[model samples]
Target: MSFSLRPQPARWFELLTAREDLTLAVETLARTGAVELETHSETATPLVLPDLRGRLEEYNRLAQHYQHYWPQDELRPSNLPGRPVDTFNHALQRLYAWRDAADAVVRRSEALRGELYELEMLREMLLAQGDTPLDLGLLAGAGPALAARLFVLPPRTHIAQIPAAILHTSVHGKVHDFLLAVGPPAEVDLLEQELTLHKGRPMHLPPWLQRGTDASLAALDQRTAAIQAEQRVLEQQLTALQEEHRLVEALGDIARLEWFLTHVEALPVSETFAWVTGWTSDLDGKVLQQALDRAQVRSLLRFPDPPRDKVPPMVFHNPWWAQPFELFARLLGTPARDEADPSRLLVFIVPLMFGYMFGDLGQGFVLLLAGLLLGRRVPTLRLLVPGGLASMLFGLLFGSVFSREDIIPPLWLHPLDQPLLVLAIPLLGGVLLLLLGLLLNGIEAYWRGALRDWLAMDAALLLIYLGGLGLLLTPYAALAALTGLFWYLGARLQRAGGDLRVLGGALGRLLEYTMQLIVNTLSFTRVGAFCLAHAGLSVAVVGLAEAGGHPLLSAIILLLGNGVIIILEGLVVSIQVTRLVLFEFFIRFLRGEGRRFQPLPAPPHKTERT
Candidate 1:
């Protein structure tokens, strides 16, 4: 029997609570993890909530700032499991104070680091001029009116004309270092601009210029040592903040919850009471009521049917054995509330199609072992065991073991021996699948009260497929029925204010359906074709083994050949089977539009078991 699941039923309810009991009531609702709360208000404008937005934003910014130093363990000091919930106001105050203190320290450290970097750059520039045999004091004593600028010119630019203001020029490999003393700021600015136009790089002149180059270097080293000492103290302070990571992360969670609660709208029924509205599962309804009662909050609950616009999220319920197949169905999509779930259908058809495409006892046994071994790590992959078993069964019928035709007697014709009969199986199966899909579509449509789809298009297509396959008395009768249904649909469209183009499009859809049946049926031919190819590949390997001459070499070749075929062919066949079933079969009947059910926020992830 096929098992299916529809969208889970929901009960809409409104709860009236005292103003003082609001906090406890909201906490209980979140803790139950059952309700999907909706906006409840008499007017369109939402009520002004608690101003927690700023606190939440600040918490986020701080978390990001210290994320690198965050503890990598589950046992956080603040958010430990079983711990009592802290007051939001207290947590917020503590976090804000910590952030302010931390920010002040960080800003001071940054300022110190910036000053140290500038000093280091100045020291390097001064050291680069240590080789220049010149009196640095002579330039400093030139007085306030005269200023000296340093320029580093590339080797490509030659200074054929020299101004008298140029004090010294020295070659430093590909660069020409020049020092010019020009009077007044205007003369200095003009000289700097001219040097820039010649592709000359200018170096910043530091304030301190006394004695010779050696004395200036000594002064720079002394200042650098002092700055380095201050930077070390700042680094230590910043490193200490790493221990506060757990506290900050805990504050983040509290801030997030407070932010969410602030946005939730509740109907203001009276000065002392507010009504909160939401939908909950049937199982969780009683649980929620008990929770509210325990909190000493007076409340009333109702189980009204949800409105059309508020469709409940779907949660599939399957038997334990068929549960794994749910993974594949969800990959396509969740089925609509009124549509059929394809997981059970896939459990049967997937193996059958895959087995026919790749049947070999040796390969099948290997696949079974692979699935069992890999299942230890990935539970879903263990579903492959059934497909492997089916393959072995088909292999027995074909009388082939390890792809050697000589090893076993044939109980049925081999794939390569009777290509037409092998091909006909998949083609016939395809036709049956198509018919089944159309029947399912009609059933689903009828269940949803869509009479046009159920009685007109779906019913006509189902009969057309059966009739075309010669299941009916005559092809003429089926053709007449199809033509009459097409005409009826066209007239219905016209009466509904459709133009000629719309009628033509409706007829086009009928033609498309007819063509789809033909094309999809032929697409299944790959099932038979691949089976024969597997046999042919094995034969080719045998030929290579024979041509090798030595028995040991031939045995090794055959072993390796079979291994490759088992891995490669197994994968190809699996993909082909999945493709045909998902695209060709499921798309025909499945309407996967329902939303998957999601509960409230889960507990924080833990890194340590304890």
Candidate 2:
């Protein structure tokens, strides 16, 4: 499935001059080589060129303009040695400056109006208390009402008397009495004196006096309004400057990127490079040929030999659904050079198990809808749309609608209500999947020319699975057959290896195989457990909703219950499904550590005037 490419001598070429057309020719040849080549340039390091000075300037301007919209620290640039560093720094400075100025203007405008509003409110509060005269003689009376109103009162204190000149009111056990004995003119003077006495403390006064003090607050509001208008004009000017900054910054980036690509093409290098190399499978070969043919490449050098060691596979850019299939292909192990179709066994099984455990029609529909709607915005969720749809399909079979079985008639049986069926299906599925994994392992081992190891290792698993299935059907006969086969395989493998170490290794593998059977069979039980948990949780939600008396409260309960089930159960099921794939299935067949192949392509350039 894997190949290592060795570069042929004839394919190598060296460029004498650094002219643009010559650079383009060299790139065309490299692309046609149908292989990734390593090279060291004698000219200036192609990656390093002019700094993004223009981009940094524009970024700074934009940052300043939007400074108020974001946190101060967000606008700051990192000190890394790249275009990003300079660009972000410039943006941060500009944003912070503009943000600070705009914020200050807004603050000033608001502060003036806020002060005026508070002053006006205070005047209105005082006016509501009304005019009252101060009585100096009443302070000496020591009557219950006088004592309660003038100062502190003990618990259960009551106002016993009020003079004709005093108005008394009690609020929440606190008494207030305004003396009406003195005329308005004399009382105003006395009130001014009392206010001075309690400079920092709250003082009781007649409401009429408070109403007459709002002229200053009205004047303050007018000043604040003027300041706010001026601030808006400054903001408008800042916005215009920011747009110009962004356009300049974008231009600088494009220019810098073009410069890098142009420099890569102009390297004074030979077609043949002294470095490690490798070849890829037929699919990779075809893709490479197509890319080259599209570019109209000709007269190129290449090595037709398969790679000697493992090489990175070439990745083709495609839509999201296609990515999973591609990733699965890579995981299953490399295909033979001549093989056109890669194995897709894992793709079907992984999703099926995921849907089975997560089955709930209503929740599944929500997931499908949300996934479809959000997939364009977030590419990663595209997989979930198909996954959710699959779950809903299975859910329908199980008659599980929002975790309640009553909504639909079961085509088979409810997983929770029929515990035996639940346990049986996952175990059977596991047995079959494990066998498939072993079969794949054997096939890959055979292809790699490790027949003995394939028989001793992968074939041993097949025997265990078949023997286990047979035992489940007819215990005594299957047990007898499995015991004989296990011993026979063990002895044969031992004799095949003459070395003492090899025998010991073979024995160790036998023990490991026995342990794996016990563990893998038990792991499938999780599928049943999750199915029951989903049903139980949904029932609990329905019970709680029904218990509530009010319609609104019941509805709220139901909403919360469904939300919890969707988020919590959804995550747990997803993790469990992935675990089954990665550990149970992948461990048996997948060799996923190979690096991907990437070929050199044409460098981008802008035409220059003569």
Candidate 3:
């Protein structure tokens, strides 16, 4: 883990394997998440594998279309004991087999389901015709050509009477009249032609439904049952085919391998060997060696000194407690490989500064509760646990609880009671924090082998700031002048090689940085300023509650006021802490230039191990 100030170190690695064992070797590497494969396929000759693009395209289309028809089983990518390219081809073939076997059954089953709904509705309408036993064959049909039809006549059709010659039964309703007509083929044709003059539209049904009342009703139920039984048989056929082929699961596996192929093709290849080069963490390198040995794949692995011209990718690791704080460092960007990571330091600084500004035992506890319950869903809220704990600790020191100061005795002087001391401490603390930041910069410069250059500027600036601090508090004005003299001399020493002109540029920058150092140190007063503001706002809340007079009203006001203080002041305090860290703290050392390490994407499960 990168518990130290620097980010995790990554080293260059190269992998060589036989052309045939290339997929196996890469799979092992990818599964271990140890190496990021560099793509050279653009320049390297591409491997000539069977074109599976057409197959994958077809699989995808069928997958979306028949997703619901797939068997109910767990889906995951499959790795057969064979070649990687064969995996896609085999899955495609299996999918095509399942589709060919199940396609007709599924379509016919779906069509029958639709027909059953219409049949059921007609059965309901037939039952509504009353309990008097009537032969449905009379209303339906007695033969193929001699059939009956139902018609809906508009209410306004009374303007012209329906022809009495039509052999029909009628039911008048609010908006329309429904008429059933039955006749021989010729008479039926003549009846329809005559009804067209009166605007009667027919509702047609299959002639097979023309049995007697009991038989026709039985026929409707029989049709529904028949449709359902056929669907069950089709479902069973699909299930058997699905289980045998594992089509859905195989498709899942093939889809994953499609992505795998892109990286595989990207590697540079020779007639007999495929070689890839990339970067991985030092620990991952060890893990990969162990994994490769276990897999027994035919591959060669080597680590060489990182090329001087190229910066190796970075991957920062932290202890679990400090992991959440990495979000702060990322806000700036990745730190240069040799630069210090400010995240570990921020773990302490963020909570310390935030708690100081938002001190209140009751509210802090509330925040802690919120964090525990919501942290999983809202990642940023993870900071609340540490911030709340620190706030509660400070709350006890300040002897405050939900704005009530008298509930506990002060372990430390309250901000409202001792404003000067409160303000003075942060200013002094700021100076030390600034000095520490400069020291971190010196460390980074040393790592980069540029300590000699760092000494001429930041080193002298650090001492001058410390010396000025001494001058302000004690009789050490001479020591402050000594540091100033050191700066002038160091500036000349740094620019002696015509690299920079000290009088023209160095003095102006030095003067400007000096002023900034002083301002940044004094800027810490806002910490105490914020503390007093919190206490004052709490007091105002209590005063407003007291003025309200009614017991319930006072309680409501107190709750509302505390909520506002917790949400509003808590947010403001968080922003203030972020400002201090990003501007006042991180600005001292961080230079975000490093590229983040990204390893090859692998199967979610461990599939390559013995």
| Model 1 lDDT tens row, 364-462 | 787788878897699877767877887888888787677777788767878888988898889888877877777777667766889675565566666
lDDT tens digits, residues 224-247, model 2?
Answer: 466567757755655555453442
Please tell me which model should have the higher TM-score, number 1 or number 3. 3
RMSD of 3: 7.7
Q: Candidate 2 — which residues are off by over 4 angstroms?
A: 1-250, 253-255, 258-310, 314-322, 325-343, 476-508, 597-610
Candidate No. with top lDDT = 3
lDDT of 3: 0.76
Per-candidate Cα lDDT values, in order, are 0.66, 0.53, 0.76
lDDT of 2 at 187: 39
Each model's Cα RMSD: 9.5, 12.9, 7.7
TM-score of 3: 0.75
TM-scores, each model vs. reference: 0.59, 0.56, 0.75
Candidate 3 wrongly placed segments (more than 4 Å): 1-3, 16-28, 39-48, 71-73, 109-235, 262-265, 269-276, 282-284, 290-300, 306-310, 374-379, 493-505, 541-561, 604-610
